[model samples]
Target: MSFLAPIPLPAPLTTRALNALRRDIVTTRLAPGETLSEATTAERLNLGKAPIRAALAQLAAEGLVQPVPRRGWIVSLVTVRDIHEVFDLRLLLEPEAARRAAASAQDRAAAAAPERLDAVCRAGYRPEDPASALGFLEANRAFHVAVAELSGNARLARQIGRLLDESTRMLVLGLRRRDRSGEMAHEHRALTAALAAGDAAGAAALMREQVAASRAMVLAALTVPDAATVA
Candidate 1:
């Protein structure tokens, strides 16, 4: 008989549960305003009630979910105002970042800068596969972060990182319709080429156009009638 020592159990349940809930909620799989019950989540995940409760509490802290007075936890609803705020920040930050990336490419001092935008465009084009969206989001972040990092301002980079997180979070929430993903990818590719070619003015112009288009999309999503709102 092979003697086997008792397998050590993994870390505590609550952390595992919290991560699972956060992943599903952030990815839009749970959908905005979707109510979550501890019992149902626990059963569905094969986790204990204690863990599920703990997880929901943490998600509430992240503003991804909220507790109702009498109902239960529901996905947080992002308002039109929220969309405006996110895009407003994007408009303020990204244009300048793109300019810097273009300058860096022109000088040939920033080897990684050019590829950053390329990677983001590549990832965005992979949106047809839902499993790839997370990677796309990560690459998108890396692109913005690269530009900021090459700006030679640590504070600016950190600020850009925080703002980009908020913007991407809202974008991910609103990107429920994958029909237009190809169009978005093309826009990104154009922006990338402008940056890589060391065309500062062109990159800045493209960045402005991209943000403006994004703002329009968000407004339309907020106001236009959709089956998503029919419930």
Candidate 2:
């Protein structure tokens, strides 16, 4: 007789639940200020309540969800403050990183960079398919992380990865309001070409422009009380 585990293990189950919940929240499928119930989440994910509950706590720590006194959990709101803070850091960090990437990148990496960007752009957002939006978001984040990593600074790369996570919801919400896939693709191509060609100045300039454009899109997609200043 073949031996098999009777039930799903807690650690793997919690990780599975966490990934599902985080993906939904980051994609804005769970939306800002939306309430979540452990039971409902468990049922929806076909997971156990304990794992879902544990996942919620982890998300709460990540600022993606908040615990209510009476209610279960709520997805945290995307604020103007959040957008400004994140973009400010990106403006300070990413262009420098991109410049360094071009400075350090090998000839073979230069050849590969544009091809990588091409693959990523091919998975751009499709209005009819929600999954495609998720694919685009994930691909975009990975591309940024790769750029940072090529910069030859591990710390900077790790920070960029974390910042990308914080920005994913904003990116998805902006996508919902308006698709910028074409512009994004074009910008990415230019940036990648500059990086691969070992043009440090050009890469930095392109990265700055891309970050600025992304900030504008997210701010425009948001409808906070200070609507006039968003422009």
Candidate 3:
């Protein structure tokens, strides 16, 4: 008689696990203030504790999770102060980067920047469509990152990349309320026009206003939840 045998498990865990966990934390699917235990996660994920621990550490680095000394990890809480400060810093730095990009970008990248930024604006605020909203957000992120790259500043771009990660989380939260995608797109077009004209000052000024406008809109939503639908 042939005996039935159990099927072996899939594959060994690796960085994919870490990345998946990080995405969940950022997207708030895991929820804020929720504690995560390596053993528990390992069991649920059908993996070992080592991989889970390592993933938790990676999440900690991203500020999506906090290590609690002897305790496990807790999901990072979203605070109004954090939201204000993160966007404020973005406002301070990104405009300068945009100016540098506009000043130096002379070929395909120059043309591409404006087009990409315009696309981001057209994406608008899409509350009912989370994936669509994220697409617009990613496009917006690429626009800023493109500016930093065009500026030819590796160090600045790296720092800005880190800031963008944190800012993205806040943005996803804000998206739950309304869609600022259209206004955002308009600002991008204006900035692009300034860039196309090689007006560094004009590009920078417009970028500053654009960033401030985004921050204010997001902050307004956070303060008044009832006003979530307002853009």
Candidate 4:
């Protein structure tokens, strides 16, 4: 019904800095492949350099930022290849999770999971508003994670969550350019229907279609950027 507890988080200052930097990176405020300086970022965020350093290291580990030798840091550059790889993995995993999730749905609470996540998504996503991207992505992440969890495989659920996190920048890139209209909602609705009907095969097929659509949409969004091209 809700998310599982994550591992121990960083210290408060580090956590704050990490959250701010991650938000900027994922939303393209800190554009992909854009350089970052610890001092500059610390001053911009009105935080200490130590915390910023810690945050950047964390981001690097998460593949959201790249560490440069002698130079400062750069936001990780996303490519079509990267999207292809992530989505390819998702294609292998998510449909199976959906099939299992639908098969496991035997209670009222289980049946309502998709709709609950849909409410969060509908509230957070607004096509005209760039600021809503983060909330929408979080809701989207929740929706996918819930489905994977319902599959009764903790490892699968965790892997799905990580893939969603890795796809954040791509989703934000697409969302910022208004690349997707109503496709996501329609896919989710159909998937939800299949899940509610306890159609395992149907749910799997719908999820596969949804993931493929997302890959295409995000790849299109990559073309809008003036920095390094993705292909």
Candidate 5:
């Protein structure tokens, strides 16, 4: 009797697994403090248990997932304190990064950031559509991260990226409650103009304002009753 050969497994799924979990967390689909089962996740994503475990480990390093004593991993909750801490760090880093980026605007790579930011601003935010909101959030993160990268400091870009990642869920929550995407787009537009003009001080000031506004909106949203389930 002839037997069929077993199907070969796909290439490493760690990146795909990580991205799926990350998107779920940020979108609040998994909800904060929810327990995660590797086997269940593996089945849900149609991935192997090894990749799910690996993804969880990666997320733990990023502060999005925490291992419990006996239970499986739990999604980390974003506290008011966490919001303040993240914004405080952003206030310290992003303004300086923007200033440096503006100074380095003459560089070909750095000069391209303004165009990217313009594209994001043009995309705007869509409150009526959930998918559009997620798209806008991704674009928003890309724009900020791009500005940091334009500073020509790899370490600084990485730091800003981490801060942005941590703050994403809260930003999404705030966006769902409030429609400030237009104002956000306007701010981004002005910031891009400043960066393109090589105005270091202006760019720094604009970055500070953007971070401050985001902090205010997020914190305000979190204070409302039952806001955690708002999304």
Candidate 6:
């Protein structure tokens, strides 16, 4: 007879709890501003209260959750102002990053940037399938971050990754409000071609246009009276 392996401790348990909560929030399953009840979360996730609390604290630090004075934790709400701020930061960095990535992609003969982006564009999204919304968001985020990484700038890539995380939530909400997946995939294909061809200026311009359009869509969605219900 063999002895049973020891169960993992709270640190690892908290990490698993954190990832579950984060996925729910990012995928809109938790919904913006939904109160997080510890008991309910623990019961639903089959986790202990200790790990849930630890996960909430970490999520709050990431701006994905907010702690109320006397109530409990709530999923952070995205506002029009938040959209503007996030896109403003992206606009400042992404265009330049794309230009650099174009040059880098040209020098690396075996670069997979074009192929990776193409795969995402080809996969596209199905408006009728609700699950496709998350797939679209993940693909979109991967394409952007991959472009940034191809720039050969670690700091720039890290910054873009963080911005993309915040942008994913807005994009998911926008997709629910309006089906722009086809248009977005088309734009990604064009941008990928420009990068592969080393057209730095064209790539930069395309990236700017893409970010601006996404920002406009999200802002417009937030302005609707039933925006909350739509998502």
Q: Evaluated with lDDT, which candidate comes out highest?
A: 6
TM-score of 3: 0.78
lDDT of model 5 at position 7: 75
- Note the residue pairs that clash in candidate 6: none
Per-residue lDDT for 86-149 in model 1, tens only?
A: 7888788878877876777756665765566566557643445666666666666676687677
Give the residue spans of candidate 1 off by over 4 A.
1-18, 43-55, 106-110, 124-142, 152-178, 227-231
lDDT minimum window of 10 residues, candidate 3: 222-231
C-alpha RMSD values across all candidates: 8.1, 6.2, 9.5, 4.7, 7.3, 6.0
State each model's CA lDDT, in order.
0.71, 0.84, 0.73, 0.82, 0.87, 0.87
Residues 123-226 of candidate 5: C-alpha lDDT, one tens digit per residue: 65667786677778788888999899888899999999989987888888888788778888898999999999999999999999999999999988887887
Q: Which of 1 and 2 is the better model by lDDT?
A: 2
Q: Model 5: which residue pairs collide?
A: none
Tens digit of lDDT per residue, candidate 4, span 196-220? 7789999999999988888887877
Worst 10 residues of 2 by lDDT: 222-231
| Each prediction's TM-score versus the true structure | 0.70, 0.86, 0.78, 0.86, 0.88, 0.90
Clash totals for all candidate models: 0, 0, 5, 0, 0, 0
To one decimal, what is the Cα RMSD in angstroms of model 6 from the true structure?
6.0
lDDT, ranked from best to worst = 6, 5, 2, 4, 3, 1
Best candidate according to TM-score: 6
lDDT of 3 by residue, 62-176 (tens): 7778999877888887677777778888887888887887787675444666665565456545667677776787777777776666667888887777777777766776777
- Residue 155, model 4: Cα distance from true site in angstroms: 2.1
